[model samples]
Target: MPESWNYLMDMDGVLVHEEHPIPGASEFVAELTGNDIKFLVLTNNSIYTPRDLRARLARTGLDMPETAIWTSALATAKFLDSQRPNGSAFVIGEAGLTTALHEIGYVLTDRDPDYVVLGETRTYSFTAITKAIRLVEEGAKFIATNPDATGPSREGSLPATGAVAALIARATGREPYFVGKPNPLMMRSALRALGTHSANTLMIGDRMDTDIRAGLEAGLQTILVLSGISADSTAEMYPFRPTRVINSIADLVGNSAAPF
Candidate 1:
């Protein structure tokens, strides 16, 4: 890797696990900050806004500015803004999603919406899902933040955006357009936000299906870290491969002497 390379890193598995910072994850971030390397923390979870996420990471000892954090909500909002400016939608999500849409001048309504936007939330509402189904059946476009079937929690895996989207799809017979990872649109949007070229960027992620695949499709070199969801044997299961594999972010800390 070159000295001028920028970084795009997954949030949950790469830097922290649930509510705690992964080993050396803080150091890696510090190294990047101290060295003035350009990077952004990416997450498919649209439950919290960037400000909320920044505070959450701070609690885990990861010192990142709000500007350094990017969420699926932001990407979705940007996509919507470009596709249909000032459009209305029946949104099923929390602050992150709603705030993003609001920032883009999108109206949130259940009446004759132009789209049905689905995002991650701790408590999925039956009433909202039903309304979403009705809206989609009535000709609203279906859109989802990501294709993740499950999200991690202290107790266990919880049904995420993808699962809920599947339910809506089943009822309405319409597959949603996912705006997050593996679509390349999310990665491209992040790259444009960071103002960096894909050739000079490194995408560090924990999932082969989402982060690595998205990075690869977006034309960036990818590194698979085994600190989160993927294990050692997991990479081989995928047809595509990462540029390199490492135990965790610890290996990359103070790696000035070696290729990143």
Candidate 2:
């Protein structure tokens, strides 16, 4: 609740709703930028790079710089690079995941890779899943960008990386190491990127299951905003609770004088 706390915020719910900018979201971002507060917009979606996400947010009237964005793809890539530098992977994902791995000098191949990496994709291919299963069965490590079972879409919720990872796990009897939200590793990576300590960092998220859990696990203060997936009533069901709850990010807009 301190005024000097750095922020780590979720993208979809805390900043914008779907493709639209949440009310007062831009002002909140502007306040942070103007004050030179270190912050990062976090997302479990591994489909787009930070640059792509920045442009998308720009269209929603929020001018978030690429440096302020962090996706699961980047976190996963960093994890892999640290765990096994220049390792090979059989990737089942899109440009974001692939590009991150490539940037870290990972070889994307099906020829006995060190890991079979799974990430969110618009169209998950059965052929690819079959190949992934085979690779895992043959002793390749399994890794997933996130544990989200479903992803938001215009039509409705679509099966996400976790669901697909479940399928592959069932087939090969190997569980995937999920590297995104709900995992403290992602928060640690984001914190390192922000160059901030957890004690003075605030994590604003909408979901108790992933964002809040991750923040708490990473030793950061968490705030649950009601503008996203979870409601106040739902908070009681969770054994763990966020440090604070707010109606929306709009409430925090120029009111940094008050403890958030």
Candidate 3:
């Protein structure tokens, strides 16, 4: 409800569901841009770049610029760059993760690299997982983009980065450092990207576990919308709570000029 509050919003449930634009979502985004409100669409899905996501969102009737989008891939790449500039990694992911690392000047190699970067992929290969485990055993630091065990798909749930990371961890006895949501590092990274202070930023998400927890840990106000995974009753089970609960982002649209 702060007048100066900037926003970091989740993408899937807040704006769209199953690649379909949610009702009032387009209006909400327009209101933000029309007022020149600073906000970023944050997501843990690391399979696509900002450009790719922007195009996809457009197809769903939500037009957003690439600069207003942030992904786990970008966060992971930034984290790695900070840890070791020009580092090499054995990456297991698609263009999103690979392109991020490449743009950051990281070499993708399998020959005893500095890290084993794991990320979301539609088709996770057993061969790649094997190589990742072997690399971890060879002393390469293990890092995963996010801790999401299951990803939504038309065919039901599919194994995500966290699930694969668990398999690698069990094999090599090395726990991966998750670089995405639920880790305050990702939130802080997004804040840095938006040039916003945590105290003056609002983290809006539907999931209480990842989004709300990440925002709380990063010292930002949190909003849990019922349009996604979390419900009103679900918040009671968590020790921490969102600062506000809304039916959807549409609620924020009409009040864009006013304090949330």
- Candidate 2 per-residue lDDT over residues 1-260, each given as its tens digit: 46587899999998999799889899999998898888999999999999999999999999978999999999999999999999999999999999999999999999999999999998999999999999999999999999999998899999999999999999888899999999999999999999998988989999999999999999998999999999999899999999889999988877643435
Per-model clash counts, in order, read 0, 0, 0
Clashing pairs in 1: none
> What lDDT score belongs to each candidate, Candidate 1 first?
0.93, 0.93, 0.93
**Per-residue C-alpha lDDT of model 1 across residues 145-189, encoded as one tens digit per residue:** 999999877789899999999999999999999999988999999
lDDT of 3: 0.93
Q: lDDT score, residue 85, model 1?
A: 100
TM agreement with the true structure for every prediction: 0.97, 0.98, 0.98
lDDT of 3 at 132: 91
- Model 3 misplaced regions, further than 4 Å: 257-259
Which structure is stronger by lDDT: 1 or 2?
2
Please identify model 1 stretches exceeding 4 Å from their true place: 256-260
Error of 3 at 190 (Å): 0.6
Q: Which ten residues in a row have the lowest lDDT in candidate 3?
A: 251-260
